[model samples]
Target: MLPKGFQYAGVYAGLKDNGKKDMGVIVSERKAVCAGVTTTNLACAACVKRARKILRRGAAKAIIVNTKYANACTGKQGERDDAEYAKIAEKLFGGPVLTASTGVIGQNMPLDNIRRGAELLKKELRDDYDAFAEAILTTDLVVKKISKTVQILGRDVTVAGVAKGSGMIHPDMATMLAFITTDADIDRGLLQRIIREVTAISFNQITVDGDTSTNDMCLCLANGLSGVRIDRQALPIFQAALTEVLIYLAKAIAADGEGATKLMEVNVTGARSLKEARLAAKAVAGSPLVKCAVYGGDDNWGRVIAAVGRSGARFDPEKVRMNWDGLQSKTVTINIDLANGRESAQAWGCDLTEGYIKINTKYN
Candidate 1:
């Protein structure tokens, strides 16, 4: 199902040994005002660099994505492959295209298949966003998509999003690629700023594995067809809608983390700053000790305490407090209230079971 005017296509590009669906496209009839965020990994993929360059110019009519080889650390060959793919997309869309790539790291792309796949997508672009969602998944077991509508000053608008990733997760921005499209016309500067803010709290707030992917990408496109131009007054409403979509996808990614058996929420409260809170949460969320405990359903609050200690956040351990299960049950009170802190925020993750180990060891 599609949310609205968005058109999509997914097909095999021969980028993997099994000949699974690899190439996909998301397109709009008119240029879409776009904002994108990529991996901060110094070793980013060629496709990541190319997409940023294109979106920097103006609006985009299409997003070309593939899953198989990450096309990272392949040097000059990777750059050439991404350039060729962009050219193929440009010809097919007859307009500017945004490219996104994912899969195994430090690998080269099969440019021939990518070019052929782009041609195929041109012929099949339809209103099937689900097909597009299925095409981009790697280790994920299910396709992720969500859409919502809200009224802004008596005007109706829609926000539709799709995402993929279940492993290599924690890759820059949780190793996922989410493409969102809206019919609202927005200024590029404002759109970029808002997208960044929403993504930081959603996609960037979750993790499974600690490794960041070289080709991570999360982008949103606003074609402004709804005639609801976002003013400063409308910005908060817009950001809230965007953040909701991203957080939904982020939780889905964690729940489906390869072989994950238990979804866990690690919340850090009473921090002096948001950044420190995030850092503390990340440390707790990524700690193997904490994950293993969750896997076994063991209420070991010490694991949480140890995680906080190593979180690189400035905190007086003697004055820190902790809780679990929403701070209601299985709660262990650590009387460190001398530090003057009492608010909380949550991070998403899952247990690191042997099942996860088995799946990653065998997955192609």
Candidate 2:
């Protein structure tokens, strides 16, 4: 079940030509503690710019999103349009609205369509979680969402997350639009720290394409509707739940990437540091050669080793051991032992296929 005190709505706003739902709104009954991680791409979207500002306050009441026009690289007008979008959402939902946009870059949003969409969203607002999940998608084949309940201070707290990413995904602040909500009362400072830490091992551990998108972002809101108060002692439990939700969504995004037919998971161990372990795992997972090998069911173990060598992780070639399992299945798992230290990390990615090229080349 979804967290309490939250309502969702999704509607078509002419942003997409096929009459697909392209606009979505998420509102919390009251202001909620909010934390966000956004794309580090220099040319990020206008919505991302506004989102950063909103997140700095550590509180938010609603989120408004659109798919199709990324609203990136559109100059001053794009920023103005984002401002207008926020004004409209704040006017409807009260205040402190986060904004997000995804799809083709270098395009401007249709102001009229957004105005109309806001009205439709307000009128249709309900507890329809699926609608909100579907409306945020662009090329994603399925909706990504997960919910879990945990105990905090003798109360039942819930955490739920939804995400969308099919391509242009990489390990630079998530590389997708992910929204997570919870009903636990959490210190905003602690929540922010938790999100950043969890993202490093979850969303930041996945890659679809080597390119990070201009509109990537992840937002987490805690409304305390469950009456569960989280203290330092209970932080670990909440963090684990949040991690599980995000990792599930991350794996889902990798599995459904563009035209991917298989999921690739890499495990790197015996690293001198956590950073090195992450670098090695992500490099292998993101390597086009490794992905193609997984796609073709080839046990090209050398490609995996080559990726690690250049991953900026210091390691001895003689001490490294590798194993590839399930290469012929829908999911391929690779294990590597650096045999140098105790640090380890895991990364997720999709097998590269010809269909990926076709989908992107024909994309408009």
Q: Candidates' TM-scores?
A: 0.90, 0.96
Quantify all predictions' global Cα lDDT against the true fold.
0.76, 0.88
lDDT comparing candidate 2 with the true structure: 0.88
Look at candidate 2 and give me any clashing residue pairs. Answer: none
Top of the candidates by lDDT: 2
Residue-wise C-alpha lDDT for candidate 2, range 223-261, written one tens digit per residue: 989887888788889888998898999899989987799
Off by over 4 Å in 1: 1-3, 168-174, 326-339, 362-364
What are the per-residue Cα lDDT tens digits for candidate 1 across 187-291? 988888878887877778778888776777888888887788889888788778878888889878877876677667766777777777777777777788888
- After TM-score superposition, what is the CA distance of residue 281 in candidate 2 from its true location, in Å? 0.2
